[model samples]
Target: MIFVETQYDQTPAALNDLVENAALAALKHQSAPENATVTIVLTDDEQMHSLNLDYLGVDAPTDVLSFPSEEIDPETGDPYLGDILISVPRAANQAESTGHDVESEAQLLTVHGILHLMGHDHAEPEEKERMWQAQAEILTKLGLGNIQVRES
Candidate 1:
């Protein structure tokens, strides 16, 4: 299951669908289990700043953050992938700078976060190449081939 919670009041209604589709695309690309579940949280910069500081020791706000979990829900027996938090304001800014709409940027971030939850990382050169390639392929499948993820 894919769950989305919007803590930001200004988020558009269509954003929820975008996030869900992006997540599903990423999961399908990764060949995740059919019963896997994940949550996506759309929030503001203030909450993102606090989360970044508390969890990653980074004092600055970020566009997206993913916390991976490998737990199974006892009741449903679904694999809980984890939670993804995205700053709506940050995504808007990034979208403005990248010459795309907020919807596309949010979807990009969604895909990026799901990739992370699926154990894709860019800490090393080779890892980054692989992850980026996978991300691009997923984005293309989502009809966002022209939307490039900005370097952070």
Candidate 2:
């Protein structure tokens, strides 16, 4: 199952579909289990800053953060992938600078987060290449071929 929540009041109503579709595309590309579950949260920079500081010891706000989990829901027996939190205001700013809309930016972030949850990382040169290739392929399949992930 895929769940989406928005803590910002200015978020669009279509955000749910955007997140779900992006997540589904990533999961399908990765060949994730049929019953895999994940959650996507759209929040503010303040919350992101706090999470970054607390969890990653980074005192700055980031565009997206993924917390990977390996737990299973006893009742449903679904594998809980983890939670993805995105700072909506940051995404808006990135979109403006990247010459794309916030919706497209959010979708890109969604795919990036899902890839992280699936153990794809860009920490090393080879790992980054593989992850970026997979991300590009997934984005292309989602009709977002032009949207590129900015290097941080």
Candidate 3:
């Protein structure tokens, strides 16, 4: 199951569908177990700033943050994939700058976060290429083929 909680009303109605589709795509791409779940939190820049500072020690708000959990929940036995936090404000700005709607930007972030949960990282050159390729393919399948993956 995929859980979506929005602290901001600006989130698009398609948020839940996009998240669930992206999660399924990620799991399929990674050959991960299907008994998995993820939580997506849509929030404003203030909350994002606090979370970024608290977790990553970065004082500024970020587009997305992924907290990957260890596989297999002891209680439910599900492959708990952990949480994904998206800053709606940041995504809006990026969408405007990129000439896309906020929903597409949010979808892109969701895919990126899912890749992270699957252990994809862009910290290294080769890793960035692989991760971006996987993200592009997934986004294309999600009908967001033109969405640009922002470099961090």
Better candidate by lDDT, 2 or 3: 2
Tens-digit lDDT string for candidate 2 (122-149)? 9999999988999899999989999986
lDDT of 1: 0.95
Q: Clash pairs of candidate 2?
A: none
Model 1: colliding residue pairs: none
TM-score order, best first, reads: 1, 2, 3
Local error of candidate 3 at residue 132 (angstroms): 0.5
Candidate 2 TM-score over all chains jointly: 0.98
Off by over 4 Å in 3: none
Residue-by-residue lDDT tens digits, candidate 1, 1-152:
89999999999889999999999999999999989999999999999999999999999999999999999999998999999999999999999998999999999999999999999998988989988999999999999999985554
